[model samples]
Target: MRFSISSDRLKEALSKVSAVVPSKTTLPILQDILFELKGNALYLTATDLEISVRMTIEPVDGEEDGAGAIPEDKLTSVVKALPEGLLLKFESLDSNRVLITTNKGGEYKMSIEPADSFPAIPESIGETAGFGVVISGGVLKEIIENTVFATSKEELRPATMGVLFQFKGDEFIAVATDGYRLVKIARRGVVNLKGGADFSGVIVPAKTLQIIAKSIEDEETCEIMINEKHIQFSTERITIISRLIDEKYPNYESVIPYENNKELVVERDLFLSTVKRVSIFANSTTNQIKFKLDPSGFVEVSAEDVDFGGSAKERLDCAYNSEPMEIAFNAKFITDILGHIDSEKVLFKFGSPTRAAIVQPYEDSEDREMLMLVMPMRLNA
Candidate 1:
């Protein structure tokens, strides 16, 4: 392949596609990026078996139409180190090699592999085969950020390693949990279906959601296509395809408690800060901290490290009229849940010390709702 593109443009495209390229693979070919030049547009593709990314760069000076694979690390390093405004030319040479030359009179040659050796890229699901949905990039990004962190990192529960995307009529819900904590966010009328089609749900890998979240622009719209086994996300110039988690997700709805009448409203910043400060004295192994709530509108946050003989306690005023109760929880988990809440105040509902506690923002918009659940830890006798 032969083409000329500005160094800055090429660098930007490479940064996006190279995210999926495997750094160390048994198959060396997977480390290279496939480059295809046609007319005045260039296509770059990279995959790591589970996920694939393809991006298109147009308006390049295409001298010839061909395809080749170049080492992703080498190409990216060269482009990034070169001057931003310099035009970089790529040309294939004899003996399976490619030459890269810059307008500043710098040249570099790297071994290239024929495009045929690369794995077959997944084709887009056509209109007749599967359903497609369009969502605002900002909305999608927010949904992913709000839930992806709660996904399980353990391999035993494959389903929990990804976020669940449930579609019910026009309501879109994203859920993630790691057994100890769960995040569920629902948005109404956010998913614009291309046709009159509905599906139950799909488990999307957390890595895929994270990549899409970083790639999409707030002003742009993202097109999503789903089939039985795979899912695809596409924007104007970039496309990403990932294999769906085949395991069935646990019924998360059953775990959410609706009968928790005990409610405590506290300043998010104050509670979060107190928890963090007290956590310093928490047992390193359990990271356990205790919350003693009083009907008098005050809550005590305390932690003790038995081994180190360290202890801390702080009292924060809150809005709670429930009977006095004490609950224990992992300080780290509480911090994570509180950090994601964007509101000034946070709401906590408790059924009992043994039952899971629900955390939410003090206010929710008409179109969106977010709920997070954190299981309570056992207190010392």
Candidate 2:
């Protein structure tokens, strides 16, 4: 392929698709990115079999319409090392090689493989009869950020290793759990379904959601297409296709308790800081921290490491009127659930020391509702 593109533009395009390029793969072709120059646009694609990313850069000076595959690391390294505003020219050379020359007379040559050797890109599902929606990129990013962290990393239970997405009417819900903690975000009127189609539940791998969150601008619009086996997220210039987790998600609703009436409201930042500090003295194996709540408007956070004889405690003012109770939890889990809360004050509802505690923002928006559940640990006598 022969084309001239600005170094910055080329670098941006390569960076977007490089995430999918496998670092270690048995198939050598998966290490390279396919570059196709046609008309005035250049297409860059990379895939690791499970997930694929394709990006398009337009208005490049196309000298000849051609395609080739080049090592992603080599091309990205060369472009990133060059000056910012220099225009780079790419040309196919003899003997299965590609030559890159900068406007300032810098030149680099790298081996290239025939484009046909690369794996076939997945076909777009936009036009097919499937569930499709147009969603704001900001909303999508928020949903992914709030829940992706809670996804399980265990390979045994593949269903819990990804976020669950459900669509009904105009409401969209995303849920993720790792057995110890779960986060569920529900939003209404945020996504516009094409043809008013709805899908029940689809587990999306956490890695895919993370890539989509970083690939698109917050203010842009994202087009999502979903079928039985795959899901696609597309922006104006970038497209990502990922295989859906085929396993059925567990019955999540049955675990969420609705009778958690004992409420304790505390400043989110203050409570989070206390938990982090107290966690330093928690047992290495358990990482357990205790919450001593009193009806007198205060909660004491404490942790102890009996093996090493380390202990710490702190008292924080809160709004609690229920009977006095002591609950314990994994300090790490509490910190993670607290980090995602966006409100000044956080509300915690407890049914008992053994029941799962519910955490949420003190005030929820009319269009968005977020609820996080963390299973408590048994307090030591």
Candidate 3:
């Protein structure tokens, strides 16, 4: 089999698909990328079993329809050295060797496994059904950045590794948390799919979604096709497929307390900045920070490390509507959740000192559709 394509176009396509190649591959074939050449288009594919991304590029000229697997690392290295606009040709001169010669007067021959030896990808698409969800690339990135940080890094609870995508009426919500803090964002006017595995509450691994989100950053809208076990994101030139986390996500609704007796409205930036500053003195093991609020409309933030004489306290004017209350929370959880709150003013809803506290945007307007829940820490005070 022999095929020739422009090095520039080939490299661009390979750059996108090669992300799926594993950094530490168990199987040698998993480290290579499958290249398929058709009449005028070239298909590039990479997979680590958990996720697969495929991209297509059209060459300036189509030589022969052929397919092969090339060592991704070596192939990328070789292509990067070739001059722009130079043509690179791939021909199976031997069963185990492929020759790559460029128009730029450089020659390189590399040993490679045959394309036929590559493991089979689920290319059939399995009678999949898709949704016509339309979300701006900016919106998608914003939600991911705000919530993905809260996803648990530990693998013991698989559901915590993913962001939950749920559809309710006209609202499309994406939520993620690591048990200490939770973020829920609702995007109205996003399409809700039917006729397929409507992946509601389906935990999509945060890592996989981040990769797919980056691939389609330039497109205004993207389609998500879902089957029983896999989810696919299709762009005009790229397709990313990822396995779904089968475990059931925790009932997040229950975790969010509705009747929090205390409420404080504060400047978002000031509150977040204070948390960052006070957290520096928090105990290393617990990272516990305290908030003292009174009906007087001001709050004192403080933290202390008894072992080292570390303590900090700050005061800020706030809008308090209920009786005085004090609460203790993990500084990291507070900072992590605060980073995602995008509003000039934010509302802190609190109940008893031991109960969870809810943080939300100041107003119920549709502009900022997010609600965060932060579990409080057991405190001595």
Q: Which predicted model would earn the best lDDT? A: 2
Candidate 3, residues 1-381, lDDT tens digits: the string is: 577888888877777777778989779999998878788787888889999888878653567777778889999988877778888877777777888878776778887777878888876353774443555666677777877888998899989999987766556688898998889988776555562223365678988877865676754566666666777777667778889899999999988998886889899899999999999999999999999998888999999999899899999999898887788999988887777777799998998998989998886556448889999988845
Task: List per-prediction Cα lDDT, in the order shown.
Answer: 0.90, 0.91, 0.81
CA lDDT, candidate 3, residue 183: 90
Q: In candidate 3, how many Å is residue 87 off?
A: 6.7
Going through the candidates in order, what is the number of backbone clashes in each?
Answer: 0, 0, 0
Question: Model 2, 159-184: lDDT tens per residue?
Answer: 99999999877889999999999999
Residue 80 of model 2 has an lDDT of: 80
Lowest lDDT sum, 10 consecutive residues, model 2, at 190-199
Off by over 4 Å in 2: none
Residue range 1-381, candidate 1, lDDT tens digits: 789999999888998888888889999999999999989999999999999998889989999999988999988888888877998899999649999988888999999999999999865654433666788888889999999999999999999999999876677889999999999999887565745455678999999998888778888888888888889989888999999999999999999997898999999999999999999999999999999999998999999999989999999999887999999999999999999988999999999999999999999888899999999999976
The RMSD of every model to the true structure, in order and in angstroms, is 1.4, 1.2, 3.1
lDDT of 1 at 298: 95
TM-score of each: 0.96, 0.97, 0.87
Candidate 1: where are CA atoms >4 Å away? 127-129, 194-196
